[model samples]
Target: MTARTPARTPRRTLRLPSWLPVDGYVLALLGTVGLAALLPASGAAAHVAEGAATGAVAFLFFLYGARLSTREALDGLRHWRLHLTVLGSTFLLFPLLGLAARGLVPTVLTPQLYSGFLFLCLVPSTIQSSIAFTSIARGNVPAAICAGSFSSLAGIVLTPLLAALLLGNSAGGLSADALLRIVLQLLVPFLAGQFLRRWVGGFLARHKKVLGYVDRGSILLVVYTAFSQGMVAGIRHLVTPARLGLLLAVEAVLLAAMLTLTWYGSRRLGFDRADRIAIQFAGSKKSLAAGLPMASVLFGPQASLAVLPLMLFHQMQLMVCAVLAKRRAHDGADTAETGGAPSVGRITPMTAPR
Candidate 1:
């Protein structure tokens, strides 16, 4: 009986490969979109959702203002060159590349899709993901933090201006009414948070985890309202599977170009590995959190189509950067171990940051 006892088999849990990280928030956004597609808000319901979305967006910005530490931002200014490089990559190089892609219109991308793509380029770099990736790769965390913060702050002003200039009538022409809405909905709340940060900063710190949910929930509400409007308007018919495939291909190229440029370009500029990692992650990615609300405000009813490229690109970047960050971390580890040149192509275990 003892000899007949069978050995227990270990259970194998199915998991996605490290190179392909699926973000749960992206899943939530897609689910929200599905809900909008199925049960779109219309008439009175639409009006209420729109109002709630607007108020949510304002409160989101207020939280942004409250959470950002002023002293840290001021100290980050000390690393001005690195910050400038990130800004130039985000605002200048990205826009130029987007402009060049206009040559593909009518051939590779529809006008509406192109507008979305260009808008994606004009949006700012991410803060949390940049910091998270930089930390994962053992890079200059403070610089990543500062660069992302500056890019986000700059984006609050620059994105609307850039949209008005680049997107023209497609972005509602940024009329006085649009500008006032931007100020009232985004800028004012942010400034209010900054003003009250001294009083509420501690509270935000304590409730950081809870407020994070609030942030994502607010964005999801904005998305639902935008998509519901789009559905009601029958804008879903505009995108075919063929167009989506082509758009994804174009976005892949765009992402590859940015990643390459940020990495090697920083190296040529004489940055060390850590700073280079910070620059690559910070400079190559766009912020979904910031871009979504801006799209809702700027594009109005057309926001659903306008944000499609950004939403797709956000997920794409997360997956690619997860693999890249792992490789980077492995290289960092090798450099430390060998006391010589860093290795490449080897992946280390890394949990993707949300």
Candidate 2:
């Protein structure tokens, strides 16, 4: 009895505060940006990095094609209206808002920054975070998954066409060369992956965790290469602290507007609580992962600045949506307790998408 177990010390692990829920991947992105600023590739190394980034972009799309299940996507098409609403919000409403913001240029935002801002609006909605948030909020998670996949597939073609039409020469124009690059770098690889998926899919599933890292690593390499080119081109001076603050403020307004529209607007359109949640999360956010590679291809050396607005927006959406998801879950629980219509779907643990 005297030799009883010694008082146990509770192990303490480091964690970010709930109020500041930053994703670890985002931190790695910031670090890669810093690395580019400090020691940018040049001369032969620049060419090498550029080549590697091009290859990485192709590989990334290949992975995207392999991971997406054709049958699931077709199955999701049965929820046609919800998917259409999300697409409208993503491609139509978001771009309209972005164009409306053009009035702020040369005052709140430089021409270059404005181009980037518009491009941010044109990119597809995220898949992983959209599903995660929808699940957390007790939304129609399957709808979210299909909506996101459709948007991404549509974006591969639409984004480039829109950029050529809107951004014009800033995005290397809509010439045959540009079209060929889009097909070769993005579409062809994706098709190849889809074709080979029967054989490679099993391997990919077995090493999903490892391949996820590879996916992220490829994007990081692309960022480093793009930022390195920007550094070499001496474009850093364009982004002053004051300009950055202004950009952040403009982006805050943009995010708030989308969130509000996607929620209330969906309700008015007859979507239920669960469908509305999926629409809001899927429609309101852009994919940094998809946008980055596309920017690198479209904007060339100016890719650095082109991706800046998107990068900031990505982090902003993550933080804001995380809080919103938790609140939504709480509201759903309260509704069930009061004998009201509970959320449509069961809440599931968040899983990383292939």
Candidate 3:
């Protein structure tokens, strides 16, 4: 038999692909952002819409609580390395970038967009999407699940605190009141779900698809409300194509810097290749779904522009990471094919459910 090494992807391809491609959800997100850029809304109607949007944001967090599995939490215990990597990336590396980017204000990116750019770095990683991609790529599904979950849990506190510390003066004078609001709006609901986890758990598993729609819809509503506020606030007048191009370049650098840091940092910390991949992918991605709603709450109408850099970076990460993930998979295949070692990713665990 010809000696063929197994394939392992670069630590990069560990995240989902749609994040990189012009997929449906991303396109939908861009459409909403573009709509806001073109037609900003105002008046008492805007106020009412904002109120509704705020309520939806709280409810979305509540549902997040209710949907997460108690059973899975137990399984997550086994993947500590993967989970820690994701959390560090989300809470530690992401915030540092947000802080560093602040020095660029009025030079490359406008002050307002720069604040938004910083806030983008403050949000959590995506859960469903990350896990979904990891599973599809035949990476460690359990580790992906746990890692994504841990990042979200940490973000409930970290994202708000980081924003307060890093983007305070820039985020329209963020108040302690906003911190309390985040706790009440996001943390409380999530805790409640944990409290009621046993009862709500089954309900969510059964209605996962329906709940997914609820989650996406809630985000869309948040976008509409925030865009309406931006319209009322005239944020559109401040952003220009040149400034946006500059923002993209800066964000590109930031994403690349982060990807390099997290991937190598974890390896230096002695994580295996699987874990290193998870860290690089999960750490590098900023959640538009999580950030958009939080940005609305934290930055109010100005959130429309603030989240723009994040939105763009979110897509950029998706594209770059998709290619990387595939390359990693192929690398694994080649490694097994060449080395004659049975590829770990392709081997089904005897314990796995049939």
lDDT of each: 0.91, 0.91, 0.74
- Residues 1-354, candidate 1, lDDT per residue (tens digit)? 457867789999999876788988999999999999999999999999999999999999999898888899999998898999999999999999999999999999989899999999999999988888887787888999999999999998999899989999989886898889999998999999999999999999999899889999999999999999999999778899999999999999999999999999999999988899999999999999999999998999999999999999999999999888877897788787888554434334456554
Look at candidate 2 and give me any clashing residue pairs: none
Per-residue alpha-carbon lDDT of candidate 3 for residues 1-354, written as tens digits (9 for 90 to 100): 998998877685455333335556767877876776676556776777778888898888888777777678777878776677778778777777777877787888788887888788778887755655454444666677777777777787788778777777655355777767888888898889888878878878898889878888889878877877777677668988899889989988988898799778988998766667666767778777778877887787577887778778877876777666667667767777898435764532111100
Give the alpha carbon lDDT tens digit for every residue of 114-210 in model 2: 9999999999999999999999888888999999999998898888888888899889998899888899999999999889899899999999999
Candidate 1 similarity to native, TM-score: 0.94
Q: What's the lDDT of the predicted structure labeled candidate 3?
A: 0.74
Top-scoring candidate (TM-score): 2
RMSD vs true structure, all candidates: 2.8, 2.1, 9.1
TM-score of each: 0.94, 0.95, 0.86
Off by over 4 Å in 2: 1-14, 343-354
